[model samples]
Target: MVMTQGWIKDNVQEGTPIKVARIYMKNATLAGDDLFIDNLFIGSDYDNYIRTSLPATPNGNFVYDVEVSKIDLGFDINFMAANCGHDFPLLGIKDATVLSGSAEPYSDIVVYGHPDFTAGTNMAVGRIVAATKPVTGSFELELNGKLVTVAADATAKKMKELVETNLDTGIVLVNQYGTCAGYAWDVEWASKGGNQPLIKVWCVV
Candidate 1:
């Protein structure tokens, strides 16, 4: 797993800019394999800047020299799974789930599922953070875990209503289906059910 934390410096001297600081886990083991850092960025009202690249050095760190000029600060972190590869069939299935109601079906859905069916699991983790003086705003976080399917009739309508109502104030929507796990119909059904992953929206009062 990857861990990251960022905050805006509030006590800078007049005319002195506040730089962004970031730390990442180096030489760490994730899901039984070595992990790699992909990219990092800091965003505010004025600008979004990418931090310097970490050089595969264990316990590596990077800092930005430019001062932050905006009141609301945001940070985004991304990482790649070390040994994961793409499963074309699974990708197609996921696309179908997301676009089930569209007028035209995505062509990618045609290539999913094979008789031999040998595909490795793909996993990704990411986080976005927004900072303020008193943190008086909202932030949205999306988590992908499991997937499921719902009946096209009343059950689907009820599920949609529950998701819209239960999602936190800052969260827009949490979606899952045929994406996280492999070509298992049960996985898809579980994600569509009420017991699957719950998205939490952050609201600072």
Candidate 2:
């Protein structure tokens, strides 16, 4: 009998998310209140530069995110509702509940006070201090838990289709940066209704 390593394979071709770069944090003033990770306070007002804190349940202010003292959907609903198709890219943090093996989809992504997060590299499975967009520079994809400059043609197309259908249910979440409108591209999910072994992002159009 001959032993074969060829039989070994990975669950996902793109692999899983890895922490390549350290997270980038913004300096902030507490506005008369103390802050902690994932606290959802106004790190910079709703415009993403919270200086002072607003009410426990602030309304429509450019303050950080949410007023969930009343379970305010973190006020993220207001942001999404107000900014749905603006095409003006904003920063976001992955929700706390988004641990391994499951994702909360659109609701899982938030605008502010997400432990004061912003865009950068590395989507660690359970890191609250992390981001989801508009990386200050070009980004890469994860293949086998390692960052790759690009994905294979088949892998790129497959990741897009799988995540779109499974996570977004074929709904277009966001476009590939610097591309034409209506292009159906999306972000990576820790798990989109199932386990995805790697950090899959737009390596292809």
Candidate 3:
């Protein structure tokens, strides 16, 4: 096989300003393998910065930084509820039997304390902390777990109410789909059904 060699030379020293004048190839050749130039990084003094515990990019420009907590586009719930368009439709539970000292059949439904918990046999699950009804049709419930915190306190309280109220049930030991509203730590799992990936929030008008 015909072999070829490539070279890269840097003249700038550490802590010195660097500007690339030009890059060129020395002996142009044919009848050999093609030349490939991959991933080019300039002025990347990564190791020295780590060794000295200095800022990685002292001269880097700030492109943009965006921090978003919650967003609500008013939606018509009458239309949504009429068409069953609720992001998380309440799951109806019937004839549910709880085995003593067994992990609940759907521990991930609550999902605050048991983030990594998968449905298994004989695993202890979190307990319901509190349940309250905001309206005639909806309920919210809090279970044992870490609470999700957000930048806005009102948004956090609103979300807590939406989640806890949606799942709040008066029925003795019933399971249903719960919609978690607003920004939360565990909001990644907030959704319409069980055993599915979490989706972004949908608002009701």
- Per-residue lDDT tens digits for candidate 1, residues 68-155, read 3333442233222223222111112333223222222122222233333456422221122211111122233333532322322212
- The Cα local distance difference test for each model comes to 0.31, 0.34, 0.31
| lDDT tens digits by residue: candidate 2, 118-163 | 5442333222322222222233555454444432222234546544
Question: Residue by residue across 1-205, what tens digits does model 3's lDDT show?
Answer: 1122223234445467655588653324411112433234444442222234432221231212223333263111211111111222212223333344333333323212232445652222233321221222222233333233222223333554554555332122212232322222344244334553232333222
lDDT of 2 at 89: 23
What TM value does model 1 have? Answer: 0.15
- TM for every model, in the order presented, reads 0.15, 0.15, 0.14
Global lDDT of model 3: 0.31
Mark the regions of model 3 whose C-alpha exceeds 4 Å error after superposition: 1-11, 26-33, 46-205
Ranking by TM-score: 1, 2, 3
Candidate 2 at residue 26, lDDT? 45
Scored by Cα lDDT, where does model 2 land?
A: 0.34
The predicted structure with the larger lDDT, 1 or 2, is: 2
Question: Residue 182's C-alpha lDDT in candidate 2?
Answer: 18
